[model samples]
Target: MPVWQTIYSELSQYNFSVFSIMEDKNIEDARPWIEKSGAKFPCTIDTNHIISDLYNMFNVPTVVWIDENGKIVRPNDVVVMNEGGAKLVKVDPETYIEKIRRWVINNDPPMNSNDDFIKYKQQREHTDNEQVARAEFLIGQWLYNNGELELATQHFETATELSPADVMIQRGTMSMRGMDPMKDYGPIAGNIIKKGLRLYRPIRD
Candidate 1:
């Protein structure tokens, strides 16, 4: 978030726009954090995970680059923020920043296209299981909003079981149970690690 702030500050002079979506958070729940961040750019909430489904986002902090033609140049990826932020994942912030600059200047060069983007899009083509998981997740969100914790938990658990690879469902369920989905070192991490899963699975092109 700090890194995004820095980028926003730096690039505000250019023809750049930056916005963020807080998946799994309602507008009320997200307001305090948004205000605390002092973000100038517009931020929106995704209480129903609609954007997640559309974008095929399974994790938080995923970035997608869109061109002037409204075409996706870059699919979702774990964007390393600043040096301190990158330390958590052992990525060089400078390298990531350089790539961003190149993309900005070159406008997503054709030669630099990533195959993973296509692969991820295809994978997100929504199998029957995925549709069921999505339905369960939406129902869980509705139940949570209506103050039905037990019922919501049941639906969320079903969603997680149906879509084990989707961190959005898993973390959304955790957040409802008063857990810190992003920061807290919790069982979700252990479960994914035990299954030999990449925490930030790259979106295939």
Candidate 2:
């Protein structure tokens, strides 16, 4: 959030817009955090996980950069802009900010030609299992909202098993029980760190 706050403050002179989507198990649960951040940009709560399904989001703090032409300049990636947010991931936040500034000045920058951007889009192409998992995850969200804990748990579990690579479903399940998914879910955290996967798969120049 500090990262986002920084971008919102520092980049106001540009014509770009900055907003956020809180993709948690419940909006009420996420509201306090959003309020505490003192975010100036628009923020919306995603209850149905529809954005997650559309973008193939598997983690928190992912950003998608769209240009003035309404085309995706960059796919979903981490947009950390401070040392604190970069501590756990060991990424350089200033590097990302510089990229954003460059994009604002030059809409069709050479960074967009990078292979990682292509890979980011390619990664979102779901397989058969992932598609099934997404359905189960959505069903789980509906069930959980309707006060069916046991049935909801079953569906969420099925979704997790089917799409083991998707962290969002696993985190959603944990959040429903008021648990810290990143700290508590051993397998998910291990996979993220061990595989050199992007904690937030942002494009790098």
Compare the candidates by lDDT and give the number of the best one: 2
Instruction: Candidate 1: list runs displaced more than 4 Å.
Output: 82-85, 88-90, 108-111, 114-120, 123-125, 178-185, 203-205
Candidate lDDT scores, in order, read 0.73, 0.75
User: Which TM-score value belongs to model 1?
Assistant: 0.84
Question: In lDDT terms, how accurate is model 2?
Answer: 0.75
Give per-residue CA lDDT, model 1, range 66-131, as digits (tens): 776888777776656656656755656676666666667655552244665566667557667767
lDDT for position 140 in model 2? 85
Candidate 2 clashes between residue pairs 3 or more apart in a chain or in different chains: 77-201, 77-202, 78-200
Model 2 residue 72 CA deviation in Å? 0.4
Cand. 1 Cα-lDDT: 0.73
lDDT of 2 at 90: 56
Would you list the clashing residue pairs of candidate 1?
115-205, 116-204, 116-205, 117-204, 117-205, 118-205, 119-205, 120-204
